[model samples]
Target chain A: MSTVTLHKVCKTFGEGKLAVHALRDIDLEVGNGDFVCLSGPSGSGKTTLLNMIGGLDRPTSGEITVANQRVDQMDKGELAEIRLRNIGFVFQAYNLIPVLSARENVEFVMQLQGIPPEIRHQKSKEILAEVGLNGMEDRKPAELSGGQQQRVAVARALVSEPALILADEPTANLDSVTAEKLVELLRHLNDEHGITFVISTHDKMVMGHARRLLKMHDGKIIDDIQQR
Target chain B: MGIVFHLAWRNLWRNRRRTWLTAGAIAFSTILLVLWVPIQFGAYEIMINASLAVFPGHAQIQRPGYQEKPKIRNAIDNAETLAKKLRASNQFVGVATRAQGFALLSSGTRSYGAQVVGVEPVFESGTSSIPGLVKKGRYLSGIDAQEMVIGAALARNLKIKIGDEVTLIGGGKDGSVAAAILPVVGIFESGSNELDRFFSEIPLHTFQNIFSMGHSAHAIAIVGKTVEEQDSLLTALRQETKDRNDIVILGWEQLVPGLKEGIQVDKVSGFIFYGILIAVVVFSILNTFLMSVLERTREFGLMLALGSRPKRIAMLMMLESTLLTLMGLIIGMTIGSALVYWVHIVGFAYPGMEDLAQQYNMPGLSRLYPQLDLFNFLIGPGSIFIATNIVAWIPVLRIRKLEPVEAMRTI
Candidate 1:
């Protein structure tokens, strides 16, 4: 049931004279176990499109469906419910809470969902271990390195087992080697867990690991390539 | 709620110095309130007690117009019987009778008008402070002794001293010229200008013999455990002495008009002072919380984005404010109570108060004890706690308007 369908999505930033169109007319679909990368230059609507899919922002005029629920027409609280139950977001710079440790950060989403503590602990441990953070559960974000914190962020997104993980430039801060390792881990997670992933990034390394690539410029999608 | 508590408690210490300073403000207010209320009440109590100790006991029983007209004809003939009747009730602790009259006293070349009191020496100890306040000489010896204790101001005016012969001249009960020569035995200073200048005490039998009164008393002073019992004691006296048309009873409040009004003024001012203290502490707590919430805009947005209910975050802030205020309250009350207890044990006094009181002809201050009460202890902290939460809600409600998406964009 991990699915997303968008119909003629359009998003604008401001009203008439000073309006900045962040996303243009766009139609797209993603199925279960799809590793899709939205690759684009700066101000190219990739982040905006991902925000729409995750219900973090509303589109100006469009219809959006993720996990069989309408993301565009929902109210703020309803949108938050869908985002809480079905979608997980890994932001570019603000993914992990700075005050919480690795394990606490990973357990954040499960705690919000009213998950039992014992199960949340079990799932967070397993996910952190799966992301190569086996011995770093107690280290806070301030203590952890960029790559380790990003791993904790990824663990958080995957621990809830949401139908869709919307990550916006998750590897933009990590070095090339760490970034490659992260993309490879995401690929492995997609292969093994069958959760759909839609990542927006300008990093070529991220695009290289995707099975489908959608390139955008000036708020419009220019290329949609299914390589595999 | 547990997680919320954990986060809220930890958040308080994120700025430890600031948190403590805010709490310190509240603590300072609390300590002042706890200490000030008791001391104020104690001061009023000391004022009333000292003033009443000199002459007017807490309540008095006298013939109908003895205080207005101090003549031998206004004497109560059955004062002892009425005192015995009143003492058998549960209300009266001590009852002492006196025969008082006004006369001119002369010693060689000096003379002045004096108010003479004839009292039972042993029974006077329970009702008047004159027995305890005898300065240079001793009080009157017994019911049969021809001895007199005069006020210091009167002795100074007449140039009289211990064992000096002072002659009293006045009219007796039968309209004859009353005259007597008595040796001054003691001198008492009651610390009031008028009382020290015009009062004297002599043996009841000698005074009655000089005034030609046959076993008649002028006034009776009643003593009880506390002033709070005076009203009930008066009511009991009313019911007991209803048949005696010639006698009357009056409490000190009825005798002293301004004392109760002064106490009421102190109470009102105490409450207003405490209200200002609470307001200052509440504003300090609110200002601290508002700045804290404002500084965490991005962090709060992230929390909302992570699926925390807006109301829950507000409740968490409220919990933090409450905890902070309670911490201050505990510190303040502990220290305040300790200080109060220590002062109660050792007593509190000001330097040179005795001399100052004597110089001004006013009652001098001694060691004062405070009243420890429960309402100030509990309700004072309770009001501050509620006030802190109310002010803390102002900023958290503003935080509720934040959009997670916009918040994420904030640096």
Candidate 2:
């Protein structure tokens, strides 16, 4: 179980005349097994907030702690180690390396974890099947469809069994039906495997599957609601 | 490290066009450098050997000031003692003594100053390759007293034929005018014009008796067992002559400083040629690498997001460039080696340039043949790879500044 705590975190771009606040005084907490969805329109700083929580970006001010480690104080290499050991990411465009096969992509995170090849193979295979890519493990990303590639990416994110899976607009490019299926898959993993998932999305289909919804506007979380 | 290399390999292939272009640039530069090696060093070796063939040996033992002035006073007086010392040393194959002086040649109304050397036909011919350069008539022989062999240019300038008699006039040590009438037994052509037009060979006794030097000669020429043994031969000669107050020993290269200077000048010129080629090629390589880096920015960013560190990305780029340059170097060296081998066997021949070569009295043939110096060849390609790696760093510096989010979002 992991908890991401953000206390008065602020992010600013440039300095002086060109200073633009990307995130402002953001305090939030995400608990273990929580299916949290961050919803906002473009430039609402939702992605920035998710990146800060995932240790992909640092807050210009204040503190962030994830799974008991002080992320704000960690150097780049230390943060990378944290991400490798505890965090997984899924991008809107899937972010699957086109040159690698499905199983190779899934095994990439496990490789970073220094898992033995045999264990990585078995885990990758199992995760690929879990994401509905059973026989497509050997295919490269370019050879897979939009939906199938997203599934492979999802498999990659979960294969490491990270404490937190942070996805930025994970189903943004998929059709509604595919998006629904992906949201359902993430929600099922959270419910069944107790995997903490923080997804940033504009798709209503994704937010509807969230156990808790956080709304953002002008770099601030304006609303938070717990779904029945 | 292995993972970084794995991604580096794929990154190189991801943009096939850029990668190939960069590789081509590297290969072309490498070939240019490799080709330069043989041509530059070959010219130098040929020129140096030609100069040494006519004037110096692998090492020379002379009276202290004899090379500066070939008059009778500079002749080695204790020649028997020097010859005995030299012959005892294992470093020399043979030591040949000769008397060198200046003479004014006259054929009809035409006249020119010449450097005349009286040589012991057998010993001189054995020490140097000069006798092998004769293009017409026979070279001087042991019993051919009062007979002279003139260079082709000297023969042409004197308007003298093989059977013609030429007069050599010069001052003796006793203020007496020493003169001799000698029949030209042979005409020789040593390809360099400077040597051919100014040098003549006669029997040593005739010069020794005419100059009143009493069996003494200007210098002793020592030929080594092989070209690589020159230094050892010189060192041995120096040690042998250590107790002699009047004798000085010097290496062949030092005997002809002009030839060494010419080679150094040629080496510098050759570097300029390869430098320009490398500059053009390295610029293109830089361009290709920069474009490739830009194209892969998003991929790099994605990898970073997936937990690939910035340092890992830089390592990946560096490995890819190194691999590309190494491939280019290997291919270029292969092609260059083939060309070097072919030229070394067949030699270069310029049929119509014989007259031009004759005018210069060049020691070799009309064609400029390249020397197959393996060390020079290796140095050429090795330097190219080093240069490529240095040039390849331009792109890596840019990657080091890459922010993960910025790289991921780069289109």
Candidate 3:
């Protein structure tokens, strides 16, 4: 069964004499546990597509659905609900709330999901250890390295057990070794937990790790290939 | 709710310096109230006490219209019976009967207009403070003895020393001749310029005989144990005198409307000042929270994108502001209470106030001790609580309208 479906999706920014087409006629489908990478250069609409798929931004015209729910037509609040319960996002910058400790950052989504403290605490520690950052629950984002902060972000996303994780350049700021380690961790999550991931990145390493690869240019997907 | 609380509380400390500074400003306003309210109350209380002490007591009984028109003709004919009734009531310390009339005093070489008051010398100690105001010589010794207590300023104007005979000539109650030649036994300075210059006290029997008032008196001034007892005493006096159309009784408040008016004006001004003070403090809180909301735009957007509702995000900010306000209120009240209690114990005095206070009838230096209780606590800090809750919404509303996508792009 597909975790997300996109058909004839198009996005436009600005208007009149100053309009830019950010996405064009995007058609895509991702089954459960599918690890896909949207690879393209900057302004090639990969991040925009990822944002629309995550319900972080709505397409100007299209039918986009995730986890059996229509996302393109959802209001801001409904989109927020969709993102909270069904979709998880990993941004390029690893935007962890600076004031929160590692355990707090990991349990942030679960807290909003109304999980009790004891259960949320236990579940977050479990996820943090799985992300290879055990015994670092009390460390704040500022105290963590780039790779560790990204792992905390990943822990936060997976801790909620969402159906799909949309990452926009999740390894963009990390070294090659860190990037490899991160890809391996994400691959392990997909294999072990049956969670689907759709990542938008320019990194060749992410493309090399993707189960399926789609290449895009000028807002349209021009290549789709099975990687393994 | 616990998660929201945690988020809000931690967020406040994210800028610990700024939060403490904002809370401090709020606490500062509360302390201002804590200090100001008590001082005003203390000063007013002392002034009333001293002024009431300079005679007329806190309540009085007199012939009808005597308060409106002062003369020997308005004297209470049944004053002896009324004094008996008042004393029997035991609601007062004592009731001193008097028949006062306007007259002129001449000491051969000097003559001056004066307000001659008739008094019973032995009873004056318990009812009036005039006997205690003596600055020179002695108070009147007997009702039948031909002697008087005159004000120091009046003595100065007459150039008369103690033992000098002064003649008082005035119209009789029956339109007959009224005159007396009495030796000055004492000269008192009552602090009030008018009292010191124009007042003279002789025995009530002598005054009635000279003024031809028979056994009647102009007024019976009643003294209660405390000034606050006047209300109940007035009520009792009214109830006792209900059948008598020939007399009227008044409490201190009725007798001195000026004092009441002055206190009322001070209260209104105090409320205006307190309102402005708390308002500025609350807006300072509002400013802090607003800046926090603006600064954390990206984080807020991330939270919203992570599925926190827009209202939920706003609620979180409100929660943060509420925590900040509570902290300020607790800290400020604690500090204010400590300071107010110290002032209450040690008393507060200002230089030059002794001279100023001496100018009035109050007998000592002006050292004020403001009273504090639950009323002050409720009015001062409670106002802050309501103000803070209402003001906190400004920032929450601002955050409510924020777009997640736009906010994420803020920084």
Candidate 4:
């Protein structure tokens, strides 16, 4: 079964003569456990497409199905539920809540899901360790390095064990070594846990690690390539 | 929920100076209100007690229509028996029967019209502060003594002194001439110009015989231990006289309507000042929370994208304000209560207040003891708490309108 499907999705910002079409006629599908990468230059609608798939933005026209639920038709509350229960997000900025410690950041989603504290603690610890962030559980985002903060974000995303992960330029702020390590971590999680990933990136390292690559130009996908 | 609380608490301290400044404003306002409210109330209490003490005790029982139009014929029949019943109850500190009439008094050429109240000396001594306030000679000696205690102003106006004779002439209850030639045995200075200039007291038996009001008096004045006890005492008085339609029970507010109205007007002005104070603090709270919200736009967007609801975000912001308000209230009330308690023990008086009070016939306000009751203690801090949360909602409402995509782009 497919983890996500988009048919004729289009997104526009503003209105009238000033309108900017951010996405146009996007059609795609990612099967369960597939590792897919969306690569493009600036203004290529890669992030907008990722936002659409994650239920963060609504398409001006078209249908988006995530985990078999029609995302485009859901209300804001339903969209939040869909994001909470079925999808995880990793942002380009390593958007860990600045006030929360690393472990608390990892446990935020579980807490929102009303998971018990003991179990949440246990799961957060294991996930932080998997992301190679052990012994750094109590450091706030400000106290951590860029790569460490990114790992905490990764741990936060993967700890909830959602069916799909939408990453928007996850390696944008990392050095080559750290970016390679992050891509490897994402690949490991996708391969070991059978979690599907749809990553939007300009990094060759991240794109090379994906099993399939989709390239986009202005606001439309120009090529779909299978690497492995 | 616990995580949200933790997050909110940490967020509040992100700008330590701003948080402290906001909380300090709240604390300062709380302290001002906490201190001012009880003082105002204490002043009101003093005013009520002082006015009541001058003549109209905490309450009174008079014949129907006597309060509005007190005529010599509008007397409560067997008033002493009712006073005896009221005095028998432990609810009252003092109860005394009195007959009052408008009489023309003359002392060899100087003449003035005054209200003459005839009272039982011993009972009047217990019920009225006038007995203790007599500046010369003494209060009346007997229930039938041909003696009078006139006010200092009246004594001055009539050019009479103790041991001098004054003639009183008035219309009797039976339409005959009520006339008396009495010696002034005491002179009292009540401080009130009206009472001092136009009021005098004589023995009840003399008043009854001269006015032809046998077994009757104008009012039965009742004094309770404290002004707060007036309501319950008035209720009991009403219940005691429920079977009699000829008499009506009245509390101090009814007996002296102007005093109550004065207090009401003063309270409204006090509330207006307090409203301005609280509104200033509320705007400070609004500014603080709005800045916090604006600064954390990206963080909120990230949280919303991670599956937290807008309601949850709003609650988190509200929790921050609640925590801040709670901190301010705790500190403010603690310090405020301690200060008020100290003042209550030592008493508070403004400079030159005694002279000012004496000038206005309100000697009670000279030294005020602010009582920090539960209502006074909570009212100020409670208003701040409620207002802080209410004003906080203005900024928090912005969270509901935040689109994760748009908010993330805010910076």
Candidate 5:
């Protein structure tokens, strides 16, 4: 079954005089547990496409269905509910709320989902250890290294057991070795835990890890390929 | 609801410096307002009660228009009957009659214009503060044929003391001018310099004879059972005197409009201060909260995108502001109330200004015990609560207009 689908979608910003078309006529689909990479250079609508697919932005014209629900027409609260329940996000900046500790950051989405404290803690610690940062769980984002923080962000994404994980340039700010290690961790979660990954990136190193790759340029998908 | 309040409280500590500063500002303003209002209101209280003690005795009964003109013509001849009726009503502690006239009091080479009040000596002593404030000589006895009570300042002006006979010359009945000699009986000092300088008291019969009114008193003075009973007593007197269309019953507020007007001025000024205080505190709180909201722009977006409702975010911001303000209010009220209670106990004194107070005939600089009405405290802190709540919306409205994409990039 498809976990994400976008049909003839467009994203226009501003109104009338200042409007810019950020994404135009985008059609895509990703099945459950299928790891897909959306690779593009700057201004190629990679992040905008990812945002629409994740239900964080509404398409200017067309429909987006995620996890069998018409997410394009969902209200802000409904979109938030979808994001909280089905979608997990990993960003280039590793946007952890600086006030929360590592373990707390992993537990935050579950807490919002009304998961009990013990269950949240147990699952968060389990995921933190899987990401190879178990003992550093109490440290805040500022107290950890860039790679460690990104790992914590990845841990937070998977801790909620979301079906589709949207990673926007998740390795853009890290060194090649750390970036490779982070991608391996995401691939490990994808392969072992059956989590689907839709990664948006310009890095060849990131795209090389994708099982399916779609290339984009100037707001249009240029090439699609599948690997064994 | 409990989560909201708990998170709000925790958020206050997240910006400890800002929270503490806002609270300190609110608390200090509350303290100032609490302290200033009572002292201001207490001034009016002291003026009214002190004046009524010596002159009006809370209320008065007289021939209609007698208070306005107070001429010798509008005399209440049935003063005894009126006094009896007033006593029977059980509203008055004492009912006394007083006949007043403009007279020239002369002793040797000195002469001064004086208001000679003809009071029933025995009853007037208990009704008025004159006997209690005597500085020299014995108070006049009801049976003393030629006894008088002169204010110390008036006595000094005439340079006469007890046992000295001062001749009073005034217009008598039918416009005839008459002269009578009355012995100076005692010197009284009633704190108010204006009163001590111009007023004199004499036996009721002596004043009637001196003014040639022949046993008639110009008005009756009624004292209430207590300060709280003054209004009811005045109302009852007005009701009973309504039949005697020639008579008017006046509460001290109406009888002494100037003094009452002065007291009202104090009350109005107190509210103005409170208004100014609320404005200043409100502005400070708004400025602080706006800065905080501006700084938290991206974080708010993240929360909203993560699944918090727009209204819930607003509610959260409002909750935070209210929590901060309440903490401030509790601390402010504690400090402010303590200061108010201290002033009530020890009072604020304006030292070396006694002469100025005496010259203006205002309540002198003793310990100025300030008394506040019940609503003053409630309104004081309640205004801050309202102010912070209203101000919190400015940030909430700003956030509401933000698109999630734009809000996410605010950092």
Candidate 6:
């Protein structure tokens, strides 16, 4: 069974002479528990494709299916619900809510899912510990380092146990060692938890960890390579 | 929802100085409203009571057309008997019968035209301030004393001193000459130029005898214990005289001429001032929340992308505003109530207020005591809470229109 399927997906930005085609006729499928990497240069539409699959942005044309639900046809509220129930997003900026502490940031999605407090607390604690952030659960995002904040973001994304995690340059701001550690953590989660991941990155180390890689240039996918 | 509240509260303190400043503005406005509303109302109460004490007690009963025209012919027959019954009811503090006629008084060729009121001396002292305000000599001694208490201004105009005999001449109720030679027993200064210059009082029986009014008087002035009792007293008075169509009951508002209109004008002006104050505070709230929302655009986009609905984001902002307003209201009400209560107990007087009150002929109005009932206490803070929430919606509504893709790019 496929966790994500994209058919002839096209995204255009702006209009008239100023229009930029950010994604063009993209057809791809990721099997359940597949670890996929999308690799490209700056304007190669890697982030846009991730956005389309996560239901964060709508395509100018074509259909996108994630976890067997049509993503392109859903309303904003429905899209939000689909993301809540099936997809977890990790942004490059390590977008942890600044007001929330590390544990609370991880528990935020569960709270929105109406999980009970005892369970949410226990789960959040376990996830933060797994991310090696034990004893730092009470520290706010500003109190954490770059690598720690990114780990917190990853903890938040994984805590809800969604079927697919879409990471957009998740390690771009981290040093090579931290970035390698984060990729290792993602690989461990993918291997042990059977959680599918489609990561958009320019890092060779991150691309090397993926079971499959898709290379793109000028909004068009140029090559698909299966490595493991 | 509790998490949302928690989040909202935490967000409010992200910029602690800004939050405190905004809440402090709200608190200041609340304090102003809480104190000013009661004080203004207190002043109005003092003004009413002082004005009523000068003559028109809380209410009056007059022969139907007498309030408008006040001709001697339009007099209430058996007015003394009616006043005695009203006084017996124990509903009023004082009830006095009075007869009034326009008369010309002369002392050695110096003359003045004054409305000569005939009052029952014993009851008049309880019901009217004039008897207590005698600056010279004494108030009239009996119901038929043939003695007069004239205003000081009238005495100066007529060149008559106490113990001097003055001749009053007027057309009688029976179409005959109403003439009298009476001694000026007292000179009272009422502080009002109109009352002091044009008003004089003789005994009610003396007035009836001289005017050929035969057991008839113009009005029965009734004084209640407090101004708040006026309405129920008026209702009871109306019921008491319901069958007697020859008379009308008038409350102080009606009896005092422009007093009601004056209070209404003052109230509207007060509301305008308060409105300006509320507008200023509401704009401050708007500015604070708008800035908060604008600065948190990326954070909101992150939340949206994390599967939080737009309404939840809006609710978070509203909860922040609600919490801020509640904090301000509690602090303001606490401080304001203490201050108002202290002033209410000890009383408040402005500089030169006594002299000013006397100058305006409202002498008892020198000291104002604020009345802080539930209405006055909550009105100010309640308005702020509601206005803050309403103003906050301006920024909060923008969250509903936010697209995660667009909002995430705001930074």
Categorize the docking of model 2.
medium
Candidate 4 CAPRI classification by DockQ = high
Sliding window of 10 residues with minimal summed lDDT for model 1 chain B: B356-365
Residue A32 lDDT in candidate 2: 89
Worst 10 residues of 6 chain B by lDDT: B356-365
Give one digit per residue, the lDDT tens place, for model 3 in A1-228.
Answer: 999999999999999889999999999999999999999889999988988898878899989989999998788778888888898888889999988888998888998888999999999999999999999999999999999999999999998899999898999999999999999999999999999999999999889999999999999999999999
- Per-residue lDDT for B112-138 in model 6, tens only? 899999999999976788998888999
DockQ, 0 to 1 scale, candidate 5: 0.42
User: Candidate 1, which segments miss by more than 4 Å at Cα?
Assistant: B59-78, B88-93, B98-121, B136-187, B194-220, B226-257, B270-280, B353-365
Instruction: Let me know the TM-score candidate 2 reaches against the reference structure.
Output: 0.89
Worst 10 residues of 4 chain A by lDDT: A152-161
Clashes of 6: 0
Model 4, range B1-411, lDDT digits (tens) per residue?
778889989998999999899889888888888888998999899988888877899898888798999889999889888888877876778888999999999999989999999899999866778887788999999999999999999999999888999999999999999999999999988878889999999999999999999999999999888899877888888887777899888889899999999999999999999999999999999999999999999989998999999999998999999999888777788788888898898889889988866654455667998866889878888889998899999999999999998899987
After superposition, which runs of candidate 3 have C-alpha atoms over 4 Å from their true positions?
B63-77, B106-112, B144-146, B165-179, B235-246, B352-366
Candidate 2, RMSD to the unseen true structure: 3.3
Q: What is chain B's TM-score across the candidates, in the order shown?
A: 0.79, 0.85, 0.89, 0.93, 0.87, 0.96
lDDT of 4: 0.91
Q: Against the true structure, what is each candidate's TM-score?
A: 0.82, 0.89, 0.90, 0.94, 0.84, 0.97
Q: What does the lDDT come to for candidate 2?
A: 0.79
**Between candidates 3 and 5, which one is better according to TM-score?**
3
DockQ of 6: 0.88
- Find the number of clashing residue pairs for candidate 5: 1
Candidate 3, residues B356-396, lDDT tens digits: the string is 65654354446777855578666888888888888888878
Rank candidates by lDDT, best first. 6, 4, 3, 1, 5, 2
How does the DockQ of candidate 2 come out?
Answer: 0.57
Residue-level lDDT of model 2, residues A91-161, one tens digit each, is 88888877778998888777777888889889999999999998988998999989899889888888877
Please give the DockQ score of every candidate, comma-separated: 0.41, 0.57, 0.69, 0.87, 0.42, 0.88
**lDDT per model, in order?**
0.83, 0.79, 0.86, 0.91, 0.80, 0.91
